[model samples]
Target: MRFGILVNEGPFNHQASDSAYKFTEAVLRKGHEVYRVFFYYDGVNNANKLSEPPSDDRHIVKRWSELAKAHNLDLVVCVAAALRRGMKDELLAEGFRISGLGQLIEAGIQSDRLVMFGD
Candidate 1:
């Protein structure tokens, strides 16, 4: 099955992101495919590659990046959320390109299920 995972919480001050990551990992291990991981609201922090976690805490940013790289997953971040949180991907910050709900819509239809990890 194809899955679309939507995360809506920041990596810190909440367990939503970690839960999302675990859910994604489980989906992949079950022989399912992830259409995309959509980051909305504070979830956009997952896309900010500059995140630096405390030495004792887990490095969630790098873990998310690895998930995308290892599985060739589409990690989609909501442009509005990203900008509001000061997260930029060079292209967006430079040319002011922005992602929209369309990305979420497309992934939803293409995938068999939409899983939301909320706090």
Candidate 2:
């Protein structure tokens, strides 16, 4: 099945981002397509290139980037939400792009299922 993922929470602040990532990974492993992964609200933080978690912690941002690269995934951060949180194109991690809500809408239209994580 084709899937669209929407994440509304920060990577470290909540488990939503982790859950979304795991779901995406599992779907890919199952040979399903992910139309897009839309990061909105605090979830936009997942694209922050400057995020520096402790060495012991899993690097969520890097994981997302690598996953996108491996699967040719579209990892999109909501432009409005990102701007509000001081995230710009240059600040985005590799494999992530800043786009508008239209991308999310397009994902919903194109994918068979729209899976959302977080509130």
lDDT values of the candidates? 0.80, 0.96
Quality of model 2 by C-alpha lDDT: 0.96
lDDT of 2 by residue, 1-119 (tens): 99999999998889999999999999999999999999999999999889899999999999999999999999999999999999999999999999999999999999999999999
Point out where model 1 deviates above 4 Å.
Answer: 91-98
Q: Per-residue lDDT for 1-119 in model 1, tens only?
A: 88999999988778999999999999999999888888898888776666778889898888887777788878888887787778777622111224887898898899889988875
Give me the candidate number with maximum lDDT: 2
TM-score of 1: 0.88
For TM-score, the strongest prediction is 2
Per-residue error for 3 in candidate 1, Å, reads: 0.5
